[model samples]
Target chain A: MNLSRTKIGAILAAPTVVYMVIFFVVPSLILFSYSFWSSESYRVVPDFVFTNYLDSLHSAVFWKVTINAVRIGLTTAAISLVLAVPVGYYLVYVSRSQTMLYLILITWFSSYLVRIYAWRTLLGTNGVLNAVLLQLGIVDHPVDAFLFSSFAVTITLVHIYLPFCILLVTSSLSEIKPDLIDAARDLGTSSLGAFFRVIAPNAANGLAGAFMLTFILVAGDYVTPQMLGGSSGQTTGLLIADQFRKTGNWPLGAAQAFVMFVISIALYFILVSLGRATGLIVKRRTINPKGI
Target chain B: MLLRILVWAVLAFLISPLIVIVLFSFHSSPALSFPFAGFSLRWYAELFNNAQLGSAVMKSLTVAFLTSVVTLLIGTTASLAWLRLGKVGRGFIEAVSVTPIALPGLFVGVSLLVLFAQAGLQLSTLTIVISHVVIALPILIVAMKARLALFDPSLEEASRDLGASQFQTFRRVTLPLIAPTLISSAILAFAVSFDEFVVTSFVAGTETTLPMYIWSMMRRTVTPLINAISTLALLFSILILLGAWLISHVRRRSAVAARIES
Candidate 1:
């Protein structure tokens, strides 16, 4: 006997739906509500109040930390995109090898903490780079700023998240049929012209998605900043984490998280819309393939 | 030529840290500085002798294994159901499931911590597993959904038309078709769970996972022993990735061969 389609769908989907609601959505609601509650003397009061939100809004430290996070996030996203697009282009258009893609993914699968630790080892005052520099007499003393600064955090984040951007852009570039470029070239478009006129438009979605994903991950990253940022390496994630673990200020932490969440969502939509507009313009250009 | 150089440079940047960590793992001195005074296996031995780290590894393995199995089962079923539904219903389900990955891990960790506490459940290994499932599910679903998207509906329809039940059709026709995806996704889920630290930190209570172990050690002090453990972890990760790459490579080659024969 066969079940109706909807019945089968419902039956199959129920477990995941129920699981996510109990595990994901309910907890999110709990978090949301907690943002409206207040915390005093390390105890969360269950009454509704806007103090947490107000504190987050009014606190100069909150803005500074949030802006710092945004700065790192954007810097990481930009650097990763710049570094990765070439690799993505090389893989899809030049080498066309699955081996290269898989090699990058292998690095992607390697432990996240290990990667950060490696950076810590490399950039420390007595670390590898400093050792080399000192031996070369490039500096009179070790650069204390290299290890614990925002610069270190940005560099580490870019390294950690670059593989994802490459994957994203490579997937996007692959979706642009080689024939489309050939068609544009056949119509007397130069190679670079064909890239701008044909390829970049088609690849915009992946580029945007990559940027957004990396931005959110980098922005929300607590570990890297906490580990490498030293005194200056504070991010909103570390702050939110501090609330729960150190201060036991759950309401304030939850409020800050939602604020970060809103900022991420806004950035995501802006990138997406920009990508769509670019894609649309490219489609219009391609309509006149012979006119080139 | 220019692009090739750039690609290689990026690759170097990506892998340099891991190489450095592995190099420093055998240093005689505790300092992370270069120019290793001497090579020794003492740190490796210390890594093994640390009972807390040993237990944390075991606990992490257990949690990762359970996470893989649970997410694989649930994600596959949900993805299959996704194929049967309207676009709106499918989108809703996808959004609900995938959003967990997009949100900050701290938020997921703290929120889950609050929820569990509110329900009057004690935090333990069980709570860790539940949180891990939430983290691992989206990745598993993304992999399974990609595989399912490629699957032909005609095969399943034909099996049903020939008087097979849905389970029989799935077992005979669909399951074998997506087995590679299932395996790879399971590996991915396991890797994510194994390497996870943030959520585990929040919900772990008094327990430890390997990441938490590594973290506490790093926070307390850097040692050659930590480097030794990191090197081992890196090696394990490389082996898993190589296995995954090889499986997909072999599958692709066979698929190409089958196409030629047909």
Candidate 2:
């Protein structure tokens, strides 16, 4: 650890690079190869074919699922970010509830499977929420209005990912200096105006970073849909997972994965660019936008 | 205001569903139905007796332990690499590690299955662990790297300057400096492997870990026992996370103390 960049670099890089190459990169390399290959009897044949890729690109089923996946990914990020901002502001700026927020975040460290099960119990037809609602006369006896829908899937995802959202946003909020907000308030800005103008603008990069993080997480997820999405709640993840599992089409799976991977990489590049394209905000007193 | 009520309500919504699962597991009722007529710990008691469930939990623990150890080893080394490398190489490693996060894990599962199938490695615990290692490696690297970044490089230098060998300095100085992160990383890897259903589903679909067992059972029929199992697993993770957080807070305070003393 005391060593310079070169010595430390070689020692550290060798094992992980080799490991990633053999384990991480090779498997995916085979997957990429399978993407270009044909399938015979559910096994990847040697023949290089573009049919799976073609079908994936042209098919309505694939497109619909892809769109749904993208929509869910983007929506979950937006909602989680919205919910996250105020909660993050409260945690980082207002509340004396560090331990409580820490407990909430700590719970997330558990297996998502366990967390999914918890949601399953709550969201299932004969589950706790429905039963309580019926007893409270919130609706007629146990209406199946909500569970196992795309809405339910999105809700579950946002809830699960909200912790990460809050953490990232809170950290971002913490990075903003207190004096900027005070300065804005002293210049005749209301509390709300000052918050939106001073704190929010300063935390834009962090918020963008948080949104990208959540969006990427929601995009690549296969679990929320598989467990909660039911038949109608199909997302790209569920489709690709099935291609590997029930369909036994490694080529199709790989092709589908490759498409999703490309989209994610595209988004990731967008994230990187957004980080560098920091010229949007006019960083001067007259352009503070608080008075305006 | 309405906002405070709403935020707290949302928080309750966020936290209660999970806590409710623990409560639901104690239902005297045979199935997973709510509006319990009475309270009973039969499922918890039955969980012990349920041979398959018990075995699945055992299997999950075993897999998790192995995955944690392996992920920690690889992650620590990777962090060492990142810290040592110049800026460009470090950036490259950061981008590379993000693959586990950016790509769907199902793809990782399929890729690993294909690799093992090609290599004639039997679809068993080995393939499962390797996949778990891949899935959990990025997390370990991120967490460990963050901790490693905080550690003072001069501590190792000081030890080495006192005639300690590089290996000895690492063992005494660098290792202790990063011990908390390593433990936290191991716990995180354990949680990832334990809760991992996707890759485990692909590679060890037939081989039942706790999550796989719950998945199959849910598909077949939801049961109170499943809730009990989930709650148990969640509680275990919550405890580990608490430890990780406690260590982090301790580190922050200790860093302040070190700065003050210096």
Candidate 3:
């Protein structure tokens, strides 16, 4: 039978909205509420108290780990951009084969566990890197710094998240018309000049978006640091995870998570404002390709 | 020239992990050290014979399949509804839906666990399935919405003008048009579900998925068996991804052909 357009749309959309509300929105809210509640003897007591927040705020370890997380996050973001921008530029402007681009990206779908495990194997005392280094006589002994350190954590995360940056930057680059570069060239601008003046500005949003996404993902990651970050690799994520899983201190964990969430949201807004102030956001508004 | 070398070097770094994993999976030694003592397939055989791992693999597949089907149904309807709304409403809803994806997986897991405990619901495979759907739904919805953005509204309007019911138009015209995107989105949903580890770790309660199994194995000790399992898992992911690419490629070709004919 016939139905009005609004009725049909509602019928189609109701399930998704309802599902998300129940599963995502409500749980997150509960988690937030739990941050204010206190725990007793390893059980969440559900009593309102600010002790967990106070404890987290007062703890030197908390700030130190949080700072460590932020440092790793920024490093991963910078390295990923450096590596991905060139490849994205090459694929969009220089490369002849779109198939090659897809093939490279397709490999990203491989298991995340395998990616970390590969690095672990390579970085371990007798792992491939050490074996090769010793054989080459580059080092007198196996490098203890390679595995179970902050360095390993950063390296593995960069490898894991780089593909996403490439994909985003490539799409942004693709939005630029070939003639825009040609126009700049006709004006007697060098190719590098055209890139700096036209290409980079237009792709700024994508670059910024990539950085933020990678930063959040890397900072919030528990497994990578726990696996690769030996003692030196401990970050805020691992600390929060310990509260929930090992200590059963749900209230404390909830508090720590909210702290992280608040800090990240604040940082994100700062970046957005800075981006707008710098005129980088203007290029995004001008080129609305609308294609995913 | 320098730029090309840098790009290729990054590409090599990206693929090196997989190459190392696959190569060592066949090493005869129990130690994960290099310089293979010769090659053997014993780890693969061991992987198959391990009952717990086999069960976990099946559980992961079952959950992934269920997640994809559920997400496809819910996300398609939601995204379509989303397109009908005004810009503000769409933006608000999209933001709310992506919350699970944006939040840390550990946070999502713990939050859901607390919610379930409060609701007096036991942690079961069903709980696992529900949590998977929460995360998987966003990917499908985003993919479907992107595909839907390119859809022509006049086709639906014309079908309606020709006296077809809304359901009839959707079934005959809209469904066929979006089937390729739906398939690819399902593949994406499946892949996300299959490899999901962190959230599953928090709520899995006695039930083990493949990643959970791998984590336990790694925590206890590293073995060639783990390597074999990882290699298999990597191959499975690559196969699914390739399937998705091929489907989308074929659809692109046919769309091009249709344009020429028109």
Candidate 4:
């Protein structure tokens, strides 16, 4: 399988390289430029200002809603991780048939919008969930409280992101050697104990990747809250959206968007370093320190 | 176990709303309410009967299809090129292209609006497709990248050494190998563009995509027409997902066989 590295390289590297430079690099600065430009009532400024970033930090409402969005983001990440990790573990470690493996993946491909839209229909006052609840005498009347609550928003996001967590976690679990589990069990460790000590710690990188990806998605999402959260669904996404669409406050919106932009990057970097460090640590200590 | 109950309930929860939308679409009632007095297909009948709504759906499908095809072509070629970049350049290529997918869609929408305005471009179908291609390009890149990573670059050289030209080698060798990924990426891109209401609302002049149409309808009056509209429109996405799922299902099964063969 000898390959001419040069010829193979030239043929594969020409088109995308140019398109990436033009569309991605050049246009991204256009976005970054807007973040720096001053805007009065959505009108772009000829002059740049450092004040937008300052203002973003100082606004009480901005901070309040941002904190709310972060809370929701972390909560969504946490809930998804908790719910998916074990199931992903089960899918990779326990499932025997290829059919079951794809059943998990098929669950991932379920229409995303339809899944979100389902929440609206189910949670709405006259929706099916309420109808069922009322009929069952669980509640005497329809619950408007179900729809548009932050709880509803969080729950919906968890459902939406659960499949993502599963995909990452199960893949991570698959990377573990099957022999390691058998070795632990044969060496007088209980099956459950072996999983916790040997398998759980080994799959740390995947867990962190799942968490970071879900957190980033949740933090950036406005639709989930706007559609399901109602009047109270004020996250930074909602704020930035309003500033752009309704308020026509481009300066403020750009400022808020930049803040969120920075936060997600920061979170991603933290997770990246953590992943790298853990992977290195795992590699260096490839043998158990106990040499058991 | 508690986990099984919870997981199934979540799946049910995920699936039930869309089913309800379909059910409501068929409801004869003018307003959305449960325990309907009767059932009829007027809403769906009316859905097709309305020319404006019907055409908007058609326009959205056309726009999404165009976006998918163009993005796929661009992305597939780009992915091929990306494979040959040095490690540092490859890292840059990966980061720069995927950064759009990471950025908030709201930011990209507004930023593209500015870019379009700055270029003095009109908010025509072409502009809409251009912007969507930018947004959808990264996703296509990602799909193609996975396939590219799997591709043995020497295979192309093998074709070339066997006396085929560059284009011929690619046409016969590379394209077929990555065809599944290319097709799936196009479908996924279409799904993204089709469901995209927020970005479309910003950039789409007076023209409406299906999501934009649904958004306006949801606000003005929660009509039975909406359920009908969504029912007809969202089926495209469902069909896409199911088809992709089936393909991946087969691929996984085959992989197991390959593993055993080895």
Using lDDT as the measure, which candidate wins?
1
Every model's DockQ: 0.74, 0.58, 0.62, 0.40
Docking class of 4: acceptable
At residue A89, candidate 2 shows an lDDT of: 77
Query: What tier of docking accuracy does candidate 2 attain?
Result: medium
What stretches of model 2 exceed 4 Å from their correct place?
A: A1-5, A264-292, B1-7, B31-34, B246-262
User: What DockQ does model 4 achieve?
Assistant: 0.40
TM for every model, in the order presented, reads 0.93, 0.88, 0.93, 0.85
Residue-level lDDT of model 2, residues B180-258, one tens digit each, is: 7777778778878888887788889468888888878877876677778877877787776777677766876786688
List, residue by residue over B56-168, the lDDT tens digit for candidate 4. Answer: 87888899899898878877766666656677667766776777765567777777766776678888888678778877888788777766777787888689889998779
Candidate 1 residue pairs in backbone clash: none
User: What value of lDDT does candidate 3 attain over all alpha carbons?
Assistant: 0.83
User: Which lDDT values do the candidates have, in the order given?
Assistant: 0.85, 0.78, 0.83, 0.73
In Å, residue A226's CA in model 1 sits off its true spot by 0.8
- Per-residue lDDT, model 3, residue A139, is 98
Docking class of 3: medium
**Ranking of models by lDDT:** 1, 3, 2, 4
Give the residue spans of candidate 1 off by over 4 A: A188-190, A269-292, B247-262
TM-score of 3: 0.93
